[model samples]
Target: MVMQTDTVLQKMSEDDFMAVFTLGRKLGQGRFGTVFLSVEKSTGREYACKLIEKRKLVTCEDVRDLRREIQIMRHLNANPNVASIRDAYEDSKAVYIVMEFCSGGELFDGIKERGCYTEKEAAKLVRTIVAVVQGFHSLGVMHRDLKPENFLFLHHQEDSPLKIIDFGSSTFFLPGESFRDVVGSPYYVAPEVLQKHYGPEVDIWSAGVILYVLLSGVPPFWAKTEKEIYQEVLHGDLDFSSEPWPVISESAKDLMRRMLDKNPATRIATGEVLSHPWVRINGIAPDKLINS
Candidate 1:
Protein backbone atom coordinates (compact mmCIF):
# COMPACT_ATOMS: atom_id res chain seq x y z
CA MET A 1 0.00 0.00 0.00
CA VAL A 2 1.10 3.58 -0.70
CA MET A 3 2.11 5.26 2.56
CA GLN A 4 0.72 8.68 3.56
CA THR A 5 3.26 11.39 2.63
CA ASP A 6 2.04 14.79 3.91
CA THR A 7 4.73 14.64 6.58
CA VAL A 8 8.13 14.64 4.92
CA LEU A 9 10.19 11.61 5.89
CA GLN A 10 13.56 12.08 7.50
CA LYS A 11 16.14 10.00 5.62
CA MET A 12 16.75 8.11 8.90
CA SER A 13 13.16 6.83 8.76
CA GLU A 14 14.13 4.09 6.36
CA ASP A 15 10.57 2.73 6.52
CA ASP A 16 9.28 5.87 4.74
CA PHE A 17 11.30 4.94 1.66
CA MET A 18 10.04 1.35 2.05
CA ALA A 19 12.17 -1.83 1.96
CA VAL A 20 11.62 -2.06 -1.79
CA PHE A 21 14.69 0.14 -2.10
CA THR A 22 17.59 0.26 0.40
CA LEU A 23 17.52 3.97 1.21
CA GLY A 24 20.86 5.06 2.64
CA ARG A 25 22.17 8.46 3.71
CA LYS A 26 21.06 11.78 2.28
CA LEU A 27 23.34 12.61 -0.62
CA GLY A 28 21.95 16.08 -1.34
CA GLN A 29 18.90 18.30 -0.89
CA GLY A 30 17.72 21.65 -2.26
CA ARG A 31 14.73 24.01 -2.63
CA PHE A 32 13.12 21.73 -5.21
CA GLY A 33 14.22 18.33 -3.86
CA THR A 34 16.35 15.91 -1.85
CA VAL A 35 18.40 12.94 -3.07
CA PHE A 36 18.82 9.82 -0.96
CA LEU A 37 21.45 7.10 -1.29
CA SER A 38 19.60 3.84 -2.02
CA VAL A 39 20.09 0.29 -3.34
CA GLU A 40 17.71 -1.53 -5.72
CA LYS A 41 15.90 -4.51 -4.15
CA SER A 42 16.23 -6.73 -7.22
CA THR A 43 19.92 -6.17 -8.04
CA GLY A 44 21.28 -5.33 -4.57
CA ARG A 45 23.14 -2.53 -6.33
CA GLU A 46 23.53 0.96 -4.88
CA TYR A 47 21.91 3.95 -6.60
CA ALA A 48 21.13 7.62 -6.01
CA CYS A 49 17.44 8.45 -5.60
CA LYS A 50 16.68 12.07 -6.50
CA LEU A 51 13.44 13.20 -4.87
CA ILE A 52 11.88 16.36 -6.30
CA GLU A 53 8.95 17.71 -4.28
CA LYS A 54 5.60 17.95 -6.09
CA ARG A 55 4.30 20.71 -3.83
CA LYS A 56 7.18 22.86 -5.05
CA LEU A 57 5.91 22.85 -8.63
CA VAL A 58 4.62 26.43 -8.86
CA THR A 59 4.58 26.59 -12.64
CA CYS A 60 3.24 24.38 -15.42
CA GLU A 61 6.60 24.77 -17.14
CA ASP A 62 8.27 23.24 -14.11
CA VAL A 63 6.10 20.15 -14.40
CA ARG A 64 6.75 20.02 -18.15
CA ASP A 65 10.46 20.32 -17.49
CA LEU A 66 10.37 17.66 -14.77
CA ARG A 67 8.78 15.30 -17.27
CA ARG A 68 11.33 16.39 -19.86
CA GLU A 69 14.19 15.49 -17.55
CA ILE A 70 12.84 11.95 -17.32
CA GLN A 71 12.26 11.76 -21.07
CA ILE A 72 15.76 13.06 -21.73
CA MET A 73 17.27 10.50 -19.38
CA ARG A 74 15.40 7.71 -21.13
CA HIS A 75 16.55 8.99 -24.50
CA LEU A 76 20.18 9.07 -23.34
CA ASN A 77 20.41 5.62 -21.74
CA ALA A 78 23.97 4.58 -22.66
CA ASN A 79 25.54 7.94 -23.43
CA PRO A 80 28.95 8.18 -21.79
CA ASN A 81 28.49 11.60 -20.14
CA VAL A 82 24.96 11.06 -18.82
CA ALA A 83 23.77 9.57 -15.52
CA SER A 84 21.62 6.49 -16.05
CA ILE A 85 18.17 6.32 -14.42
CA ARG A 86 17.38 2.79 -13.30
CA ASP A 87 13.79 3.54 -12.27
CA ALA A 88 11.33 6.39 -11.77
CA TYR A 89 8.03 6.85 -9.88
CA GLU A 90 5.92 9.68 -8.54
CA ASP A 91 3.86 9.88 -5.35
CA SER A 92 1.92 12.70 -3.69
CA LYS A 93 5.04 14.07 -2.02
CA ALA A 94 7.65 13.81 -4.79
CA VAL A 95 9.00 12.43 -8.02
CA TYR A 96 11.65 9.79 -7.30
CA ILE A 97 14.39 9.04 -9.82
CA VAL A 98 16.76 6.14 -9.08
CA MET A 99 20.17 6.45 -10.69
CA GLU A 100 23.60 4.75 -10.57
CA PHE A 101 25.15 5.42 -7.16
CA CYS A 102 28.39 7.40 -7.26
CA SER A 103 30.12 7.21 -3.86
CA GLY A 104 33.00 9.49 -4.80
CA GLY A 105 30.54 12.43 -4.76
CA GLU A 106 30.75 15.58 -6.80
CA LEU A 107 33.95 16.61 -8.59
CA PHE A 108 33.67 19.90 -6.71
CA ASP A 109 33.97 17.92 -3.47
CA GLY A 110 37.12 16.22 -4.73
CA ILE A 111 38.59 19.54 -5.81
CA LYS A 112 37.77 21.03 -2.42
CA GLU A 113 39.34 18.03 -0.64
CA ARG A 114 42.49 18.10 -2.77
CA GLY A 115 43.47 21.60 -3.87
CA CYS A 116 43.49 21.28 -7.69
CA TYR A 117 44.73 19.32 -10.68
CA THR A 118 48.00 19.54 -12.59
CA GLU A 119 47.80 20.79 -16.20
CA LYS A 120 48.31 17.26 -17.57
CA GLU A 121 45.78 15.84 -15.14
CA ALA A 122 43.38 18.68 -15.86
CA ALA A 123 43.77 18.12 -19.60
CA LYS A 124 43.01 14.40 -19.28
CA LEU A 125 39.95 15.15 -17.17
CA VAL A 126 38.73 17.74 -19.68
CA ARG A 127 39.29 15.30 -22.57
CA THR A 128 37.19 12.63 -20.91
CA ILE A 129 34.51 15.28 -20.26
CA VAL A 130 34.52 16.41 -23.89
CA ALA A 131 34.09 12.82 -25.08
CA VAL A 132 31.04 12.57 -22.84
CA VAL A 133 29.56 15.79 -24.19
CA GLN A 134 30.19 14.57 -27.71
CA GLY A 135 28.04 11.58 -26.87
CA PHE A 136 25.32 13.92 -25.52
CA HIS A 137 25.37 15.98 -28.70
CA SER A 138 24.74 12.80 -30.65
CA LEU A 139 21.70 12.07 -28.48
CA GLY A 140 20.11 15.54 -29.00
CA VAL A 141 20.14 16.34 -25.27
CA MET A 142 21.67 19.50 -23.85
CA HIS A 143 22.98 19.44 -20.30
CA ARG A 144 22.81 23.19 -19.90
CA ASP A 145 24.17 22.90 -16.37
CA LEU A 146 27.73 21.50 -16.53
CA LYS A 147 29.46 22.85 -13.46
CA PRO A 148 31.81 20.94 -11.12
CA GLU A 149 28.90 19.96 -8.87
CA ASN A 150 27.22 18.15 -11.74
CA PHE A 151 30.34 16.07 -12.42
CA LEU A 152 30.81 13.15 -10.01
CA PHE A 153 33.20 10.23 -9.67
CA LEU A 154 31.78 6.68 -9.52
CA HIS A 155 33.56 5.73 -6.27
CA HIS A 156 36.75 6.14 -4.21
CA GLN A 157 39.61 4.84 -6.29
CA GLU A 158 43.12 5.91 -7.26
CA ASP A 159 41.46 6.70 -10.60
CA SER A 160 37.67 6.84 -10.55
CA PRO A 161 35.60 7.66 -13.66
CA LEU A 162 33.55 10.87 -13.62
CA LYS A 163 29.77 10.67 -14.06
CA ILE A 164 27.74 13.67 -15.23
CA ILE A 165 24.61 13.90 -13.05
CA ASP A 166 21.63 16.22 -12.53
CA PHE A 167 19.51 16.40 -15.64
CA GLY A 168 16.80 18.65 -14.17
CA SER A 169 18.27 21.54 -16.16
CA SER A 170 18.60 19.56 -19.39
CA THR A 171 16.79 20.57 -22.62
CA PHE A 172 16.11 18.53 -25.69
CA PHE A 173 16.07 19.81 -29.29
CA LEU A 174 14.65 18.39 -32.47
CA PRO A 175 16.51 18.84 -35.75
CA GLY A 176 16.94 22.49 -36.77
CA GLU A 177 15.27 23.80 -33.62
CA SER A 178 16.79 26.41 -31.28
CA PHE A 179 16.27 26.17 -27.53
CA ARG A 180 15.18 29.46 -25.95
CA ASP A 181 15.26 28.43 -22.31
CA VAL A 182 17.59 30.40 -20.01
CA VAL A 183 19.08 27.61 -17.96
CA GLY A 184 22.43 26.62 -16.34
CA SER A 185 24.83 27.66 -13.60
CA PRO A 186 25.45 31.40 -13.96
CA TYR A 187 29.22 31.19 -13.54
CA TYR A 188 29.61 28.57 -16.27
CA VAL A 189 26.70 29.70 -18.47
CA ALA A 190 27.59 30.97 -21.96
CA PRO A 191 26.95 34.52 -23.06
CA GLU A 192 24.54 33.30 -25.74
CA VAL A 193 22.62 31.29 -23.18
CA LEU A 194 22.21 34.33 -20.94
CA GLN A 195 21.01 36.23 -23.99
CA LYS A 196 18.66 33.33 -24.89
CA HIS A 197 20.19 32.48 -28.31
CA TYR A 198 22.16 29.37 -27.39
CA GLY A 199 22.20 25.85 -28.80
CA PRO A 200 24.27 22.76 -27.97
CA GLU A 201 27.41 24.89 -28.17
CA VAL A 202 26.46 26.18 -24.74
CA ASP A 203 27.34 22.75 -23.33
CA ILE A 204 30.86 23.09 -24.73
CA TRP A 205 31.08 26.55 -23.19
CA SER A 206 30.15 25.12 -19.80
CA ALA A 207 32.74 22.35 -20.31
CA GLY A 208 35.37 25.04 -20.90
CA VAL A 209 34.33 26.64 -17.66
CA ILE A 210 34.76 23.22 -15.98
CA LEU A 211 38.26 22.99 -17.46
CA TYR A 212 39.10 26.46 -16.23
CA VAL A 213 37.87 25.69 -12.72
CA LEU A 214 39.57 22.25 -12.59
CA LEU A 215 42.96 23.75 -13.44
CA SER A 216 42.77 27.17 -11.78
CA GLY A 217 41.08 26.18 -8.50
CA VAL A 218 38.84 29.25 -8.82
CA PRO A 219 36.14 30.42 -11.17
CA PRO A 220 36.91 33.07 -13.80
CA PHE A 221 34.58 35.48 -12.11
CA TRP A 222 34.29 36.29 -8.41
CA ALA A 223 31.20 38.47 -8.66
CA LYS A 224 28.61 38.56 -5.89
CA THR A 225 25.54 39.09 -8.03
CA GLU A 226 23.87 37.53 -11.11
CA LYS A 227 24.29 40.53 -13.44
CA GLU A 228 27.99 40.88 -12.64
CA ILE A 229 28.57 37.21 -13.46
CA TYR A 230 26.95 37.55 -16.90
CA GLN A 231 29.10 40.61 -17.58
CA GLU A 232 32.30 38.75 -16.67
CA VAL A 233 31.36 35.70 -18.78
CA LEU A 234 30.43 37.88 -21.75
CA HIS A 235 33.75 39.73 -21.58
CA GLY A 236 35.80 36.55 -20.96
CA ASP A 237 37.54 37.62 -17.74
CA LEU A 238 39.71 34.50 -17.36
CA ASP A 239 43.28 34.77 -16.07
CA PHE A 240 45.42 32.27 -14.12
CA SER A 241 47.33 34.23 -11.47
CA SER A 242 47.03 31.86 -8.51
CA GLU A 243 50.40 30.65 -7.10
CA PRO A 244 50.15 26.88 -7.63
CA TRP A 245 48.89 27.09 -11.21
CA PRO A 246 51.18 25.38 -13.76
CA VAL A 247 51.36 28.36 -16.16
CA ILE A 248 48.67 26.97 -18.46
CA SER A 249 49.73 26.79 -22.12
CA GLU A 250 48.48 29.18 -24.80
CA SER A 251 47.04 26.18 -26.66
CA ALA A 252 44.81 25.36 -23.74
CA LYS A 253 43.88 29.00 -23.38
CA ASP A 254 43.17 29.14 -27.10
CA LEU A 255 40.81 26.22 -26.79
CA MET A 256 39.11 27.84 -23.82
CA ARG A 257 38.73 31.15 -25.62
CA ARG A 258 37.14 29.38 -28.55
CA MET A 259 34.81 27.27 -26.42
CA LEU A 260 33.74 30.23 -24.29
CA ASP A 261 33.25 32.45 -27.32
CA LYS A 262 30.38 34.89 -26.77
CA ASN A 263 29.03 34.09 -30.20
CA PRO A 264 27.36 30.70 -30.15
CA ALA A 265 27.96 30.11 -33.87
CA THR A 266 31.64 30.82 -33.40
CA ARG A 267 32.09 28.32 -30.54
CA ILE A 268 34.56 25.48 -31.14
CA ALA A 269 33.20 22.18 -32.45
CA THR A 270 32.79 19.46 -29.82
CA GLY A 271 34.16 16.68 -32.03
CA GLU A 272 37.24 18.74 -32.89
CA VAL A 273 37.83 19.71 -29.26
CA LEU A 274 39.03 16.17 -28.46
CA SER A 275 41.95 16.71 -30.85
CA HIS A 276 42.99 20.01 -29.29
CA PRO A 277 46.69 19.95 -28.42
CA TRP A 278 45.89 19.97 -24.72
CA VAL A 279 43.61 16.94 -25.07
CA ARG A 280 45.66 14.80 -27.49
CA ILE A 281 48.16 13.44 -24.97
CA ASN A 282 48.52 9.81 -23.85
CA GLY A 283 49.84 7.90 -20.76
CA ILE A 284 47.50 9.23 -18.07
CA ALA A 285 44.80 6.69 -17.15
CA PRO A 286 41.67 7.31 -19.22
CA ASP A 287 38.46 7.81 -17.21
CA LYS A 288 35.07 6.87 -18.64
CA LEU A 289 32.56 9.71 -18.72
CA ILE A 290 29.63 7.49 -17.69
CA ASN A 291 29.76 4.50 -15.30
CA SER A 292 26.99 2.36 -16.90
Candidate 2:
Protein backbone atom coordinates (compact mmCIF):
# COMPACT_ATOMS: atom_id res chain seq x y z
CA MET A 1 0.00 0.00 0.00
CA VAL A 2 2.87 2.37 0.79
CA MET A 3 4.37 1.80 -2.66
CA GLN A 4 1.03 2.39 -4.39
CA THR A 5 -0.47 5.85 -4.88
CA ASP A 6 -3.84 5.96 -6.66
CA THR A 7 -5.52 9.05 -8.03
CA VAL A 8 -8.49 9.98 -5.87
CA LEU A 9 -9.92 12.12 -8.63
CA GLN A 10 -9.74 9.30 -11.14
CA LYS A 11 -12.28 7.17 -9.26
CA MET A 12 -14.75 9.98 -8.58
CA SER A 13 -15.78 10.98 -12.10
CA GLU A 14 -19.19 9.26 -12.25
CA ASP A 15 -21.66 11.94 -13.26
CA ASP A 16 -24.73 10.35 -11.65
CA PHE A 17 -22.95 9.58 -8.36
CA MET A 18 -25.46 11.48 -6.23
CA ALA A 19 -28.39 9.65 -7.79
CA VAL A 20 -27.00 6.29 -6.71
CA PHE A 21 -27.25 6.84 -2.97
CA THR A 22 -30.20 7.92 -0.84
CA LEU A 23 -29.04 9.82 2.23
CA GLY A 24 -30.56 9.11 5.63
CA ARG A 25 -29.60 10.29 9.12
CA LYS A 26 -26.34 12.11 9.82
CA LEU A 27 -23.73 9.98 11.54
CA GLY A 28 -21.05 12.54 12.39
CA GLN A 29 -19.54 15.86 11.45
CA GLY A 30 -15.99 17.16 11.12
CA ARG A 31 -14.13 20.29 10.07
CA PHE A 32 -14.61 19.76 6.32
CA GLY A 33 -17.02 16.84 6.05
CA THR A 34 -20.37 15.48 7.17
CA VAL A 35 -20.97 11.75 7.48
CA PHE A 36 -24.38 10.32 6.74
CA LEU A 37 -25.97 6.89 6.77
CA SER A 38 -26.75 6.29 3.11
CA VAL A 39 -27.99 3.41 1.01
CA GLU A 40 -26.98 2.55 -2.54
CA LYS A 41 -30.12 2.53 -4.66
CA SER A 42 -28.80 -0.08 -7.09
CA THR A 43 -27.86 -2.74 -4.56
CA GLY A 44 -29.84 -1.50 -1.52
CA ARG A 45 -26.66 -1.75 0.60
CA GLU A 46 -25.99 0.54 3.54
CA TYR A 47 -22.87 2.73 3.73
CA ALA A 48 -21.41 5.74 5.48
CA CYS A 49 -20.81 8.61 3.12
CA LYS A 50 -18.56 11.45 4.19
CA LEU A 51 -19.32 14.53 2.13
CA ILE A 52 -16.61 17.20 2.15
CA GLU A 53 -17.06 20.57 0.52
CA LYS A 54 -14.16 21.81 -1.56
CA ARG A 55 -14.79 25.42 -0.58
CA LYS A 56 -14.35 24.59 3.13
CA LEU A 57 -10.96 22.90 2.70
CA VAL A 58 -9.36 25.98 4.37
CA THR A 59 -5.90 25.30 2.85
CA CYS A 60 -4.28 23.48 -0.05
CA GLU A 61 -2.82 21.09 2.54
CA ASP A 62 -6.37 20.09 3.48
CA VAL A 63 -7.02 18.94 -0.10
CA ARG A 64 -3.72 17.04 -0.07
CA ASP A 65 -4.68 15.38 3.21
CA LEU A 66 -8.09 14.46 1.81
CA ARG A 67 -6.48 12.73 -1.16
CA ARG A 68 -3.89 11.06 1.04
CA GLU A 69 -6.60 9.77 3.36
CA ILE A 70 -8.58 8.40 0.43
CA GLN A 71 -5.53 6.65 -1.00
CA ILE A 72 -4.49 5.24 2.37
CA MET A 73 -7.97 3.96 3.20
CA ARG A 74 -8.45 2.45 -0.24
CA HIS A 75 -5.13 0.61 -0.22
CA LEU A 76 -5.18 -0.43 3.44
CA ASN A 77 -8.76 -1.76 3.43
CA ALA A 78 -7.65 -5.40 3.29
CA ASN A 79 -7.28 -5.50 7.10
CA PRO A 80 -10.41 -6.41 9.09
CA ASN A 81 -9.74 -3.86 11.82
CA VAL A 82 -9.61 -1.01 9.30
CA ALA A 83 -12.66 0.76 7.93
CA SER A 84 -12.79 0.19 4.15
CA ILE A 85 -13.82 2.68 1.53
CA ARG A 86 -16.33 1.10 -0.82
CA ASP A 87 -16.36 3.88 -3.40
CA ALA A 88 -15.67 7.58 -3.92
CA TYR A 89 -17.73 10.07 -5.95
CA GLU A 90 -17.12 13.74 -6.55
CA ASP A 91 -19.32 16.58 -7.85
CA SER A 92 -18.17 20.11 -8.54
CA LYS A 93 -18.77 21.31 -4.98
CA ALA A 94 -17.91 18.31 -2.77
CA VAL A 95 -16.53 14.75 -2.62
CA TYR A 96 -18.39 11.77 -1.21
CA ILE A 97 -16.45 8.89 0.36
CA VAL A 98 -18.61 5.81 0.82
CA MET A 99 -17.29 3.54 3.57
CA GLU A 100 -18.35 0.43 5.44
CA PHE A 101 -21.09 1.30 7.89
CA CYS A 102 -20.09 0.50 11.46
CA SER A 103 -23.16 0.14 13.68
CA GLY A 104 -21.54 0.21 17.13
CA GLY A 105 -20.61 3.54 18.69
CA GLU A 106 -17.31 5.10 19.72
CA LEU A 107 -14.97 3.36 22.22
CA PHE A 108 -14.83 6.59 24.26
CA ASP A 109 -18.56 6.52 24.89
CA GLY A 110 -18.22 2.95 26.11
CA ILE A 111 -15.45 4.00 28.49
CA LYS A 112 -17.56 6.85 29.79
CA GLU A 113 -20.45 4.50 30.47
CA ARG A 114 -18.28 1.88 32.21
CA GLY A 115 -16.30 4.50 34.18
CA CYS A 116 -13.30 2.10 34.03
CA TYR A 117 -12.29 -1.46 33.25
CA THR A 118 -10.32 -4.29 34.83
CA GLU A 119 -6.78 -5.11 33.69
CA LYS A 120 -8.03 -8.09 31.69
CA GLU A 121 -10.69 -6.06 29.88
CA ALA A 122 -8.42 -3.07 29.35
CA ALA A 123 -5.67 -5.38 28.01
CA LYS A 124 -8.12 -6.81 25.48
CA LEU A 125 -9.06 -3.36 24.22
CA VAL A 126 -5.46 -2.15 24.09
CA ARG A 127 -4.44 -5.28 22.21
CA THR A 128 -7.00 -4.56 19.51
CA ILE A 129 -5.81 -0.96 19.17
CA VAL A 130 -2.13 -2.02 19.16
CA ALA A 131 -2.90 -4.57 16.47
CA VAL A 132 -4.43 -1.85 14.30
CA VAL A 133 -1.43 0.39 14.96
CA GLN A 134 0.89 -2.42 13.87
CA GLY A 135 -1.15 -2.93 10.71
CA PHE A 136 -1.00 0.79 9.89
CA HIS A 137 2.72 0.95 10.63
CA SER A 138 3.33 -2.01 8.33
CA LEU A 139 1.58 -0.03 5.58
CA GLY A 140 4.00 2.89 6.19
CA VAL A 141 1.09 4.98 7.46
CA MET A 142 1.04 6.73 10.81
CA HIS A 143 -2.28 7.61 12.44
CA ARG A 144 -1.34 11.01 13.85
CA ASP A 145 -4.54 10.93 15.87
CA LEU A 146 -5.06 7.79 17.99
CA LYS A 147 -7.86 8.18 20.49
CA PRO A 148 -10.78 6.15 21.84
CA GLU A 149 -13.19 8.12 19.66
CA ASN A 150 -11.42 6.93 16.54
CA PHE A 151 -12.15 3.31 17.54
CA LEU A 152 -15.63 1.94 16.86
CA PHE A 153 -16.99 -1.53 17.45
CA LEU A 154 -18.59 -3.34 14.52
CA HIS A 155 -21.68 -4.45 16.47
CA HIS A 156 -23.24 -4.58 19.92
CA GLN A 157 -21.87 -8.06 20.57
CA GLU A 158 -19.69 -8.37 23.65
CA ASP A 159 -16.84 -9.80 21.59
CA SER A 160 -17.18 -7.38 18.69
CA PRO A 161 -13.80 -6.32 17.34
CA LEU A 162 -12.92 -2.63 17.27
CA LYS A 163 -12.54 -0.89 13.91
CA ILE A 164 -10.13 2.03 13.57
CA ILE A 165 -11.61 5.03 11.76
CA ASP A 166 -10.92 8.61 10.61
CA PHE A 167 -7.64 8.75 8.68
CA GLY A 168 -7.80 12.45 7.86
CA SER A 169 -4.96 13.08 10.30
CA SER A 170 -2.85 10.18 9.03
CA THR A 171 0.15 10.47 6.71
CA PHE A 172 2.74 8.32 4.98
CA PHE A 173 6.14 8.13 6.62
CA LEU A 174 9.23 5.97 6.55
CA PRO A 175 10.38 4.22 9.73
CA GLY A 176 12.65 7.02 10.93
CA GLU A 177 11.05 10.00 9.23
CA SER A 178 10.25 12.89 11.56
CA PHE A 179 7.02 14.90 11.39
CA ARG A 180 6.79 18.45 12.69
CA ASP A 181 3.00 18.85 12.59
CA VAL A 182 1.37 19.20 16.02
CA VAL A 183 -1.56 16.94 15.31
CA GLY A 184 -3.69 14.79 17.68
CA SER A 185 -6.06 15.34 20.60
CA PRO A 186 -4.53 17.44 23.35
CA TYR A 187 -5.09 14.91 26.15
CA TYR A 188 -3.44 12.11 24.19
CA VAL A 189 -0.55 14.00 22.53
CA ALA A 190 3.07 13.05 23.21
CA PRO A 191 5.69 15.43 24.60
CA GLU A 192 7.85 15.41 21.46
CA VAL A 193 4.79 16.40 19.43
CA LEU A 194 4.58 19.54 21.58
CA GLN A 195 8.27 20.17 20.90
CA LYS A 196 7.31 20.07 17.20
CA HIS A 197 9.57 17.07 16.22
CA TYR A 198 8.37 13.47 16.31
CA GLY A 199 7.78 10.24 14.44
CA PRO A 200 5.51 7.16 14.75
CA GLU A 201 6.27 6.98 18.46
CA VAL A 202 3.64 9.69 18.99
CA ASP A 203 0.94 7.13 18.28
CA ILE A 204 2.45 4.84 20.88
CA TRP A 205 2.32 7.67 23.40
CA SER A 206 -1.36 8.24 22.59
CA ALA A 207 -2.01 4.52 23.01
CA GLY A 208 -0.45 4.75 26.46
CA VAL A 209 -2.71 7.64 27.39
CA ILE A 210 -5.71 5.66 26.19
CA LEU A 211 -4.53 2.66 28.17
CA TYR A 212 -4.35 4.79 31.29
CA VAL A 213 -7.85 6.14 30.70
CA LEU A 214 -9.18 2.66 30.09
CA LEU A 215 -7.70 1.16 33.27
CA SER A 216 -8.79 4.16 35.29
CA GLY A 217 -11.59 6.58 34.46
CA VAL A 218 -9.15 9.49 34.29
CA PRO A 219 -6.41 10.70 31.99
CA PRO A 220 -2.76 10.80 33.09
CA PHE A 221 -2.70 14.56 32.47
CA TRP A 222 -5.85 16.69 32.73
CA ALA A 223 -6.62 20.31 33.49
CA LYS A 224 -9.18 23.05 32.96
CA THR A 225 -7.77 24.30 29.70
CA GLU A 226 -5.92 22.75 26.73
CA LYS A 227 -2.84 24.85 27.53
CA GLU A 228 -2.75 23.56 31.11
CA ILE A 229 -3.18 19.97 29.98
CA TYR A 230 -0.31 20.35 27.50
CA GLN A 231 1.90 21.81 30.21
CA GLU A 232 1.24 18.78 32.41
CA VAL A 233 2.01 16.49 29.49
CA LEU A 234 5.37 18.20 28.83
CA HIS A 235 6.21 17.98 32.54
CA GLY A 236 5.39 14.26 32.43
CA ASP A 237 3.95 14.18 35.94
CA LEU A 238 2.18 10.83 36.11
CA ASP A 239 0.21 9.78 39.19
CA PHE A 240 -0.39 6.18 40.24
CA SER A 241 -0.80 6.65 43.98
CA SER A 242 -4.58 6.84 43.88
CA GLU A 243 -7.29 4.21 44.56
CA PRO A 244 -7.62 2.33 41.24
CA TRP A 245 -3.91 2.79 40.52
CA PRO A 246 -3.04 0.57 43.48
CA VAL A 247 -5.16 -2.21 42.00
CA ILE A 248 -3.78 -2.30 38.42
CA SER A 249 -0.96 -4.71 37.71
CA GLU A 250 2.61 -3.41 37.71
CA SER A 251 3.20 -4.77 34.19
CA ALA A 252 0.35 -2.61 32.81
CA LYS A 253 1.67 0.52 34.52
CA ASP A 254 5.20 -0.29 33.41
CA LEU A 255 4.04 -0.51 29.80
CA MET A 256 2.23 2.84 30.11
CA ARG A 257 5.31 4.42 31.67
CA ARG A 258 7.47 3.27 28.77
CA MET A 259 4.92 4.42 26.21
CA LEU A 260 4.45 7.85 27.82
CA ASP A 261 8.16 8.60 28.21
CA LYS A 262 8.94 12.29 27.58
CA ASN A 263 11.56 11.60 24.92
CA PRO A 264 10.19 10.13 21.68
CA ALA A 265 13.55 8.38 21.09
CA THR A 266 13.12 6.38 24.30
CA ARG A 267 9.39 5.76 23.98
CA ILE A 268 8.21 2.28 23.06
CA ALA A 269 7.76 1.58 19.36
CA THR A 270 4.43 0.27 18.01
CA GLY A 271 5.96 -3.18 17.36
CA GLU A 272 7.30 -3.44 20.90
CA VAL A 273 4.10 -2.04 22.33
CA LEU A 274 2.20 -4.85 20.62
CA SER A 275 4.64 -7.35 22.12
CA HIS A 276 4.55 -5.91 25.63
CA PRO A 277 3.48 -8.37 28.29
CA TRP A 278 0.45 -6.30 29.19
CA VAL A 279 -0.80 -6.22 25.59
CA ARG A 280 -0.14 -9.92 24.98
CA ILE A 281 -2.18 -11.17 27.95
CA ASN A 282 -5.36 -11.02 25.91
CA GLY A 283 -4.22 -13.91 23.64
CA ILE A 284 -3.26 -11.42 20.87
CA ALA A 285 0.32 -11.68 19.61
CA PRO A 286 2.49 -11.51 16.51
CA ASP A 287 1.61 -15.06 15.43
CA LYS A 288 -2.05 -14.87 16.51
CA LEU A 289 -3.33 -11.34 15.95
CA ILE A 290 -6.89 -10.07 15.90
CA ASN A 291 -6.55 -8.40 12.48
CA SER A 292 -3.71 -9.90 10.46
- Highest-scoring model, TM-score: 2
TM-score of 2: 0.89
lDDT of 2: 0.81
What local distance difference test score does each model get? 0.74, 0.81
Provide TM-scores for the models.
0.84, 0.89
Looking at candidate 1, the ten consecutive residues that score lowest on lDDT are 283-292
Error of 2 at 243 (Å): 2.6
What tens-digit string does per-residue lDDT give for candidate 2 at 104-145?
888866555554445667777888888888888888998989
lDDT, model 2, position 191: 87
Model 2 RMSD vs true structure: 5.9
